[model samples]
Target: MITLIRVDDRLIHGQCIVRVLADFKIEKIVIVDDFTASNPVLKNVFLLATPPQAKSVIFSVEETKPNLLQFIENNENVLLLMRSPTVALELFKSHPQLKMELNIGPISYRPDTIKVTSYTYLSTEEIEAVNEIAERRVRVYFNQTIDQKIIEWNEVKNLLRSG
Candidate 1:
């Protein structure tokens, strides 16, 4: 079963490995990102970052689509991590059965993106994509680590609409 569906641009990093993993006792990490899945160097980097206590599998969005259900059903205490809202949105769009609430973490500042929170930023497209995901009945929240306060999706939605 999926313990958490996290969106963190840095993918698997210290914060994730130290705080989130131990907090959830996540036995498996299913990284769903195209860039990391295809590039051996990037994939190796993520693999190295992951703690040996937990196993991780990297898969591209397209590759993960068909196997998503299996990944969730077969694994116990799984944490699915993606680099962006778009990636999580894709999964929800293709596999609506992924009805679990999504946790939004660090989304590093980028050229076209606006800061929604200290660690969370979104471009116009990303904001809309997030809104659509919520409309699909999925809950999304911003939380950098297990200790931080979770900023709800509606709060983000309102912030985007106002500014």
Candidate 2:
């Protein structure tokens, strides 16, 4: 019973804690980020940011599949968060049985990355991965918050190709 699968570089932040929690009755926050999960200090920071009523845990990308199986078995209402489109692509590849939509938000500008929109950014590799995900019949859209306008990948696909 996963409610949402979100990709935000800033995994758990003030805005996300406020916006996502308000829109979805998220019972559990599962963060899948290798670095964040392995770092004691950063891991505690993300966990501490979780709402009191909602349970939270962090796992490496390699560990999410088995955990997701249990979450499904228990019918847990989950909000799965991860860092990048690459991670999302990996998840889709690893768990091909999953039928989930992807919502992307706030990938900060970095070297070799193209600014797709105000909040969304992508490298050439990332853009290709995104297209690959969409080709797999997954609905992939970009929205900063639940209330904001959702920009479908198709809307930007051609624009990116011309450039």
Candidate 3:
């Protein structure tokens, strides 16, 4: 089952391996991203970065639609990490059955993206994509680590609309 779903640009990093994985007892990490899956070098980097004991799979958004259920059905705790809210929104669209709250991690500062929160930022398209998900009643919150304060999506959305 998916114990945690996070959108972190850095993917599986030190904080992820040591904090998120350990706290959630994540046995596997399913990274849903087309760019990462298409590039073997990048895929290998993510695989190598994962701790030896934990299994990791890099699947394109399309590939994940069919296999996501199987992964969830398997008797193992899993952490589903996406590179962006856009990707998570895509996954949720195809697999509506897989309903879980989304944890917004590091969105990373980009050239044109607006800073919604310290670690969460959104571009024009990203904001719309996230709003689509929020419309579906899926809870999205900004949280860097297990200890960080949770910032609700509505609060962030209002901030975007105002500024």
Candidate 4:
């Protein structure tokens, strides 16, 4: 089963290996990002960054639909990682049966983005995407690491005054 479905900008990094891996007791990290999956170097980099405790695999958006259930069946503990809410929204919309929570983590500041949290910055499009995901009954929350308290999307939406 999917232990945690996380939207982390930096897919597999120091924070992930140091905190998330242990905190979540993740056994397999399924990265659902088209760009990173298509790029060999970036895929290898993320794979290398993944700690020995958890195995990491990359898959594109389309690939997820057919393979996600299979991935979950095979892995004891799964951490579904996506780079953005866009991808997570796609997965949530496509795979409705797979009930899971979405944890937004460390989305970097971008040109057309507003700061949602210190670690999370989102563009107008991303904000809407997340709202849509929450509307579908998927509980979404924001936090950099497990050590911090989670901020629910409801609070975030109220803060944004746009949800």
Candidate 5:
């Protein structure tokens, strides 16, 4: 069972190791990213960042479809981390049975990307990807810290569509 599902540009960072995982008591972290999975150096960097007790596994988008079910079955309290909203949308497409609200975390600003909030940014493609996911009824919210108010995906989507 996936205890937490987060879409953060920085897959495994200080916030993730020190706060997110600790807050949720996540024992296993499954990072679904094509680039990180294929690159050894990046994969090791993430591994090093993870807490000693918390196991981290990086899988390409293609591999995740086949492996996600097994991973979820093995660990009841797993934190599912994706590099971007697009990746999370892809994962949801492949594994629709995994019903969990998506947490829109830090999506760093990039060229031509619209800043949804201080912590969230979206390129045209990223916005479209998120819109598709939201259309599927996957609740997306922007909440960096536990106390922050949840910003609904529909609100953001409408803003993007209108602007």
Candidate 6:
């Protein structure tokens, strides 16, 4: 089963491999990104970053659509990683049977993006995508590491409303 679905701009980096994998006891890390799927060099870089014990694989959204259920429905604990809320939203939309918890990890600041939390920044479209995901009954939270305090979906909504 998919243990966690995370959105981080830097997908499958040191922090993700070290913290999330170990803490969650994840058996596999499935990265769904078009760019990484198509670029062998980038895919190898992400794969190399992961430890030997953990299974790491990269698949584009389209590549995953047909066989996503088979990939995630197994008994093994899997962590689904995506680089953006847009992609995460798309994946969730395509595979509605996925886990309900959507964790928002590091989102690099862009000029047009607003800081929702210390680690998360979002553009207007991203904000809308997040809202749409929540509307689908998926709970979204901001978490960097497992030990940190979680910022729930309502808090993000409040931040967007206040800002």
Better of 1 and 2 by TM-score: 1
State the lDDT of candidate 5 residue by residue for 10-112, as single tens digits. Answer: 9888778878888888899999999999999999999888888788988898888888888667755899999788888888888887765889889898888
Better of 1 and 5 by lDDT: 1
lDDT of 2 by residue, 4-24 (tens): 888899988877888886688
lDDT by residue for model 1 (66-90), tens: 8888866875788989998888889
Model 3: ten consecutive residues of lowest lDDT: 91-100
Sequence-dependent TM-score of model 5:
0.93
Q: Is candidate 2 or candidate 5 better by TM-score?
A: 2
lDDT of 3 at 27: 93
The TM-score values for the models, in the order shown, are 0.95, 0.95, 0.96, 0.95, 0.93, 0.95
lDDT for each residue of candidate 4 in 36-135, tens digit (9 for 90 to 100): 9899999989888888888888989998789988765664789999989999999888788675688999999989999998899999999999999999
Write out the backbone clash pairs for model 1.
none
Q: Of the candidates shown, which would achieve the greatest TM-score relative to the real structure? A: 3
Q: Over the full model, what C-alpha lDDT does candidate 4 score relative to the true structure?
A: 0.88
The digit string of per-residue lDDT tens for model 3 on 60-118 reads 99898889999768888889999888998888888887756889888789998999888
**lDDT (tens digit, per residue) of candidate 6 on 71-129:** 67798888888988888889888888888889999999999999898888899999999
Angstrom error of the Cα, residue 26, model 4: value is: 0.7
Show where candidate 3 strays beyond 4 Å: none
